[model samples]
Target: MQQMITLITNSISKDLPATLEKSLKKEISSLGPVIARAITPIIEKCSASAVADSIQKVVGDRVVNQLDKSVSAKLEATVARQIQMQFHTSVKQTLQDALRASLEAFLVPAFEQSCKTMFEQVDSAFQKGMSEHTVAIQQQVEATHTPLAQTLKDTISSASSITQNLTAELLDGHRKLLALLASGNAKAHSTNVLQPNNVPVTGPPEVEAPLDPMKELGRLISERKFDEAFTMALQRSDVSIVSWLCSQVDLRALCSMVPVPLNQGVLLALLQQLAVDIATDTPRKIQWMTDVAMAINPTDPVIAMHVKPIFEQVYNALLHLRSLPTTSPSDSTSIRLFMHVINSVLLSYK
Candidate 1:
């Protein structure tokens, strides 16, 4: 019985634990179904939320960083380009302003004053000297008139040789007067002296004026009073005044000193006036125009305006002359020759 009890006791111990374990497993299995049903969705929800937060942080940081870098780079590049452009513009403007100021300060006024002084001095001296010389010549001529006439009559009565000699003497005196007048020494009392009807005075007479306007103009040009000289030339209406101005000026030299484009208008006007003089049948005028045209840029509008018409006129005149017979030269031939020379000279320019 005791041995049977021991075996039963040992078997009971093993069987009892096994049985309890089985019961426990069955109860846990039942509870697992409930737990799975209830807690599975909650756990999934929590895990999903955590994952979404992590992704949001990562993507937000990456996007934000990229945008910041792009914005910063673009702003920096824009600012640098703008600064460079502004700096370049400012430098160019400053340089132009400085150059303009320098020109205004030095050149214009000095030239004007020098011309005024030169004109005044020359005009005064020429008039004073001319007047004194005129008075002296008049007095000498009057004193010798009666005696000279009587001697001439007496000589003519005696011999044919004496009359011829007396005539020659009178002719020599007349020639002297013409010389004085041609030299601009004789008083231009009337514009009529230029006419064939008016007799000229033949004596050393002092002119009343102190200055010769022509000489004054020449002096101004030589001294480089270009602006003033040009102004004076334009103001004077006298053909002689214009002629003198054209004669004195060195057109090439004047053009060289003058700046282009800026002074082109003034220079062109001067050229136009010169062309008028040339067409007036003055060879010196033609020569002056040729010199001026050569000195200026060919593309210059003023030069083109002045020269193109002259070229056409001369070319047409030549064609007309060619059609005529080759006979003794007339005034028309002279005109044709002058035009031909003008055409040749103008073509040589530039």
Candidate 2:
């Protein structure tokens, strides 16, 4: 025992503590991981058991056992009241702020609609007033002009009677003139051209056209060489050529002859071609027209019916000329020419 004590004391007094501390420091660095590894399972086991026990106490029926759940109902009611109060005031306040930020979204359109309705009402009233005013003005205008309109209507009505009376008087004078021409004629005309069976009338001695030219004219009329016949007749310097031709030839059969059926308009134009202005005795005008009218028979009621419009036009032209203060020689000649043609050729069937 004494020897063991002495050896321990020497070992302690020797490099045992310092060498042990150095070896322990060197190994402690490596041994720390080993110690942690060894104690980790034990520490983890202890912590898990403690936490499980704590969880079981809290989450299990421990609170009921510990406090008999006396405050749970009050705490739940407190929490619900707090949450409801927060939702009612705080959430509603936030929603109100959001709605206020977007206030113009609905309000602007509503304001525009209200304005539009007001404008439409005003416009309708304005248009209604204008329509009523226009009607009033129209009524006034119509009332003011009614008398003038009636007077104008009456004047127009009387104008027609005046025109008809004038026309009838003019026609009566014309018939008298024609009768005078027939009665007072100084020349003997062949009735063969007008009245085929009438006996010859003895009047003033007349210079007769040559028999050959008259026979040639008859041949041309029979042959239907109308244009050639008319050219020959109009080309003759003597106005008596037309009277002679009408007196000798069947002019209706001559002028109406064409390869194709001509319109009455063409026949009218052809008849008017016979009106050539030649300087001749004024008395011969009525005589030539008389001879032509006898052939065409314009004085006949049936022929006159067809030639009424033509006579009216000729009559109107003459009246218009008379209305003029003075007339050119050409205008007077044209009027006379038109009168001659109407009295003779246009009244013919051709």
Among the numbered candidates, top lDDT falls to 1
Q: How big is the positional error of residue 278 in model 2, measured in Å on the Cα after superposition?
A: 26
lDDT per residue as tens, model 1, 162-252: 3344334333332332233334432332111211113344443323222676776777687877655654554343445656676666665
Q: Which stretches of candidate 1 lie over 4 Å from their true place?
A: 1-219, 252-262, 275-281, 301-350
Candidate 1 weakest ten by summed lDDT: 189-198
TM-scores, each model vs. reference: 0.26, 0.30
Residue pairs in candidate 2 whose N, alpha carbon or C atoms collide under 3 angstroms:
none
Clash count (model 1, backbone only): 25
